[model samples]
Target: MPEYLVAIRSGRFDLAALKNLNTQRKDQISPLISVRGTSLQDFDNFVDDWGDRLFYLDISRQPKDLKEPRQQPDKPQKINILLERDLNNPKNAYENKRSFYSEQLEKNKNIVPVVSWRANDPIRDIARCAILLNKGGEQAIGVRIPIGKNGEPSNHSKEALSTILNSLPTPEKCVLIFDYQHISSFPSTDEDSWIFKTLSLAQNDYNIERAFLLSTSFPKERPDNGSSMITACLDWEWQATLRNSFEILGYGDYATSDPDGEMDFIPGMPTIPYAGYFSDSHLIWWTKKEGKDKEFSKYIGIAKEIVRLDYFHDDDFCWATIKYEEIASLGGGDKSGYGNNGVWLGFRINQHVAAMLNLANVNDSQIDEEIDLF
Candidate 1:
């Protein structure tokens, strides 16, 4: 009998009841499916113990089970494919563990498609991440979109997306990272709506293998349509009629706020928009002082200041330091949204300059802290 594991919320699950459920599940299988409900720890133990022999179903965890199996393909039926969202981030050990597993899966001859979601990151890192998945004679299809400061998709961003989709074959089974807009100008200008339209066609015409759309911040004015992120994505799916084929998953809980605060925006870094887009028009805030005045005048001024400061390598904020005195001496009221003393500034300054920021050692170069601006 082939075995499987089901993991759920720890506190809500009843251990004794699960033991019986496992028995029931096993009996129900024609030949018998050895399905078991266990804690995350035990599951990890099983993978460690079974190594490449155990196939796993991590309902909400990364694809770690795939790693060992992929590394050793001789272990067939060792893993079964199930729908799950394995979000990879360098910060979390568990997340990294699963990512490693997925990477291993890509190497296997078995064609298992992985659907992943990542906040927008640096261009080089994005390319590197995609390349890893394509290793060992495997091809990974991906779609990326950039979210703006207001948390909306920029005009040019939409168009760049269209080019990628339009270029793909209609019935494509690809790995898409929802709302990853790293490259500046995707395809060209005046193609903003192309993304939405192409996606519609992808679901309607091409019958896309899997579709993942990253949603925007919910609008408080529309209480009836809360959960905009999920809502927007579903709306696209439904209208496109691709809902049947696609499963939209949220990496972060919709009800809860993201603690990392705009995981896509790297502190003290400038992003070149895709071709056909105006790169200079958008400003990326790297420090709290820079975000102080968000109005057009303030925003534009700060953008220019960053260019100058980054050019000169000033001492005050060169290494992620906050210029309290410069801000305090301004003697201005804290109406900029940050409270008095500028404690409310949104981000920390970066210390690296272009000369100092080296991407060779850091596999993940999206972080501003690791990269130098000068």
Candidate 2:
């Protein structure tokens, strides 16, 4: 099992962060790539670029607003047509349909399909899991159990898990992901106990091979001011708490992005010139109103401020820090571009992953200090 399971939406920046990781870092992480809407194509491209790497693939429930109205056959008929298609034949008639995702899974040995135990439609989820397991080995499946509002497993999660597991073979070999998404603060003792109980159930009942706790404290709303720090010690503290009780659980979180995931920028709205850097337990941000200066100059300013911060990791810290220094040193009059929001997000996520990996070697005292701060 990998040391860390990082969850990231299948966006250009998120994928780029993973792809840009150094070899040693890449080897330590197993990304849980969540694909939604047309971003499925982006995930496919990432797979092509990254080559063979063990990672989890979750086809997120597409938002209703984002769904394009396309003429398609009924669900059952579509499934039958897809299952009947020639697996070996490269040119299948349903290539343009939703079966494209399943086909991608069939061809990619390294990609593990993640079936959410909190799914609204357990039947459809079960069928999807069955198809993927039948094509891609049964060993390559992950059951994601999301935490509900009361900080415990969702009501339907256990029932859904039982149904899905009974339909598949070698359920014990399947990985388990317990996702406690978007915690506003460190988990209380009661919440921790609830999580521990759920994990114990998984271990005693399912005898699963591995399990991971996933979460994030990144703010859902954007910062209201020019520069501020957001304490992101919630996930770390929760993991530490759980590890004290349940020693076998692995670590995972939504890297840099908020737990709600990425959002598209409005075309007409003005966007602030901003940069975010992930330190040990905080997200240090610098921002300025748009039109205050040239875009490159604003970024350079932010970079300079970031590098000078007390918590700033130097240029050798990671690939992102190197780029930060490069931007910091550029002349204001230079015509070179500093890239857009996507590029900036890539930098934050890349550094965030490196910081998370470094957390493993951190002293217990230092971790306590981090948890106590803010």
Candidate 3:
């Protein structure tokens, strides 16, 4: 069976009521911890008690009632029942979460911030958590790995990870958290499975500690009767180990701004310190594939370009009005363009070098002078 994290909230209930709920949770889950408030030591104590099954008690708010109760429960009971079951077997869930985190920590010592762009946007907010690899904080490193071009890990996720890991400072320690969206990027190893194998191999080679990978992309659809295998494949054990060394730096504060529907910006890419490193104007440019509608041109720019544009208002940062003839002379205009796609452009930017572009505003004239393609 799969394990989960179950949060119990205490409302206006008296001690007896709270006790009853706790008892029920304990019965549902073999081992449970009592959390009266939020304190590092208190949370750690609960973590210690439950081993991997430890969780939070949201007594500050009243426990909400479930509409249908559980999928297979009596009428009076109302709550996400499976969550209760996971509370009973939190070890499984914790371990899976821990495994990926530990792997990230070992690979690099910095805040690894990742982002997952919108489904069609080719940009995602994947990471934005700080990491403390060792006891020292000065030697910290930060990273941002884009999990997807639009809304998933990009085709070059492995290469992106490798690049970010290599750029960090040496002899670093970390306190990390995998923001919400980046966690989903863990399961698959690309079509060739090179990234997965490399990560697994690297974990053993380096004894890393403390990390977290959070995301909305966890296994929502599991095969029938393959629950056990699915959990194992997800590497639950390793996840727990990683979680043991992690702290919930904090969840992102997101509020929607859409009038019809609230479109919230969840962190989709991997976040590292000095994230805007790749946003240099020189690294930013638009390209169009050859042979496609010369009229409907596609913008092929670097991640830093997008990040810089986003940091400043769109009106402030306009695409350089260069002639197609100029872009075509470069790599993107002809039939034998950058890639096979009739109109696909790409940016070869990473986190470290991009940060320099932060001054693009103060030095717009200089930036314009710095970047000029044929």
Candidate 4:
């Protein structure tokens, strides 16, 4: 007698239901995250100073799901996890989806620990539409801070998350995109030295599929919370490649489901406040994969190793191409008061054209139709 559902996602990527499903798709190379304002003419017009690179990103865009009219589910919004199935078959569909996520973490004591779809993909959706937010506005108070069960930090959600990141509003204008040879293990700066020549590391692996990331805010000037990237507090391997691919969007705080506060992200052992914390500019959807999708090149190599990076990637976004979940029951979540790196953005290809398309036979990376992607 198993049958339960209340999934209100749209956590990200729904460009008006993929432009009312037309097809012939292309243009997915948006990786950003800067946290504060960067001067020097915002670094040579980073991607023509973003927005309407033709109209695809629509200036500071974010705030969709506002196109009402009805019936727009052209299929693609799935999530199935049965890591070895059977929870005593009473029609056990992964024990009624883990008892409806343990009754929404026992009726939400302020929700946070959600990600159980243990890989081996069993079907994750999102195509002509479904994912709705990303960089969208209004979502702070640390996302809904409450998390306890040992992942501590509920001093009344740390005094209402320090009064909502100290009366917020001052953390926008982000645009980061890396891959200079698989992040050449970040760490080498000469005082942000013009991002070491406009954002360093590029022995020419096609320079991470270039699109835009100009500097002035990162170390080169340091102001937006003085971040220079490479987090996990400094280099806990960049906090397991950004808290394991963070995706529980809108940005941060929801500690417990296993919180282990003060930093215990654990996928590869993260324990924080090392030497990083910054956010804003979160929009990952950059495809190039032709190397026959070796499972999205092992899920962005488990997203630069941020201890299994969660908040969203662990929810396994673009799940083989799309279908992300746990967006806080869909009211949208994770962008909690920005900081903790919400763990940087994603997808920035060109590791030498993905290792020469896995050894020769290349020719896949195109789509510069004067730029215009959403």
Best by lDDT: 2
Can you give the TM-score per candidate against the true fold?
0.28, 0.81, 0.23, 0.17
In candidate 4, stretches whose alpha carbon ends up further than 4 angstroms from where it belongs are 1-32, 35-44, 47-49, 53-374
Residue pairs whose backbone atoms clash in candidate 2: none
Local accuracy by lDDT, each model: 0.29, 0.66, 0.26, 0.22
- Score candidate 3 by lDDT: 0.26
The number of the candidate with the highest TM-score is 2
Give me the runs in candidate 3 sitting further than 4 Å from their true place.
1-152, 155-157, 171-186, 189-195, 205-207, 217-374
Instruction: Give lDDT tens digits, candidate 3, residues 181-221.
Output: 32333344343443334434334432223223333322233
lDDT of 2 by residue, 25-102 (tens): 998999997664433456677888767778887655434313332334563221222123322122322122225446
Candidate 4 per-residue C-alpha lDDT over 208-325 given as tens digits, one digit per residue, 9 for 90 to 100: 2121211111121122221223211122223223323322111111110001111112244432221211211121122211112112222232232322222223333222112122
Instruction: Report the C-alpha lDDT of model 1 over 1-374, residue by residue, as the tens digit.
Output: 22111112111111111222223332321110111222244333333433233222212222332232223346534332321233344233234534645654443323232323234433333333434444532554444444554434555545444444444443254433344222222322122544455455665665655444333221212122111111111111122232233343212111111112221223454422100000111112233122222232233333334344432334342222233223333323334422221121111201111111221123323433422323
Candidate rank order under lDDT: 2, 1, 3, 4
Regarding lDDT, does 2 or 4 come out ahead? 2
Please give the lDDT score at residue 58 for candidate 1: 18
Name the runs in model 1 displaced over 4 angstroms: 1-99, 102-120, 136-173, 177-195, 200-209, 212-374
Write down the lDDT that model 1 would get.
Answer: 0.29
